[model samples]
Target: MFDEFRAKRVLSRCVDLRKEIYNLPSDLNKLRKTDPKKYNDIKIKLRDIV
Candidate 1:
């Protein structure tokens, strides 16, 4: 029972992390045109998330 609860928690965290990472590329692309520094920062964050 404890294992099942832990598994669900881990899975939810993974899904949330995926969604967060998914937004990074689009944001990075937009920033690339206007702010290269911000784009690089986001890329680094995205890499850490993945």
Candidate 2:
């Protein structure tokens, strides 16, 4: 039972991470247009996260 629960949790976390990664490009674009200075830092952070 514990193993099954852990698997479910991991799968859900992976799905959430995938969603974030997929949305990253749009976020970068918006940041670049709005705050060019911070864009590079965010891009690097997002790269590390992925």
Candidate 3:
């Protein structure tokens, strides 16, 4: 039962990661200049993912 729950949780997170990756801006340089906060946030997220 615990394993099944863990599998579902992991699957949900995978979908979330896919959505975040898909929606990320193509121009990160522009983002870094325009919105440093969001750019840094994205960097932190990517760091954790990788």
Q: Local distance difference test, per candidate? A: 0.74, 0.72, 0.87
Model 2 agreement with the true structure over 1-50: per-residue lDDT tens digits? 56998888878877866776676666667879988877776566557655
Ranking by lDDT: 3, 1, 2
Query: What is the descending TM-score order?
Result: 3, 2, 1
lDDT value for model 1: 0.74
Q: Please give the lDDT score for candidate 3.
A: 0.87
Which predicted model would earn the best TM-score? 3
Q: Which residue runs does candidate 3 get wrong by more than 4 Å?
A: 1-10
TM-score of model number 1: 0.47
For each of the candidates, the C-alpha root-mean-square deviation to the true structure, in angstroms, is: 4.2, 5.1, 2.6
**After TM-score superposition, what is the CA distance of residue 10 in candidate 3 from its true location, in Å?**
4.1
lDDT of 2: 0.72
Clashing pairs in 3: none
For model 3, how does the per-residue alpha-carbon lDDT over 1-50 read when each residue is reduced to its tens digit? 56998888878877888899899899999999999999999898878766
Error of 1 at 42 (Å): 7.3
lDDT of candidate 3 at residue 10, scale 0 to 100? 79
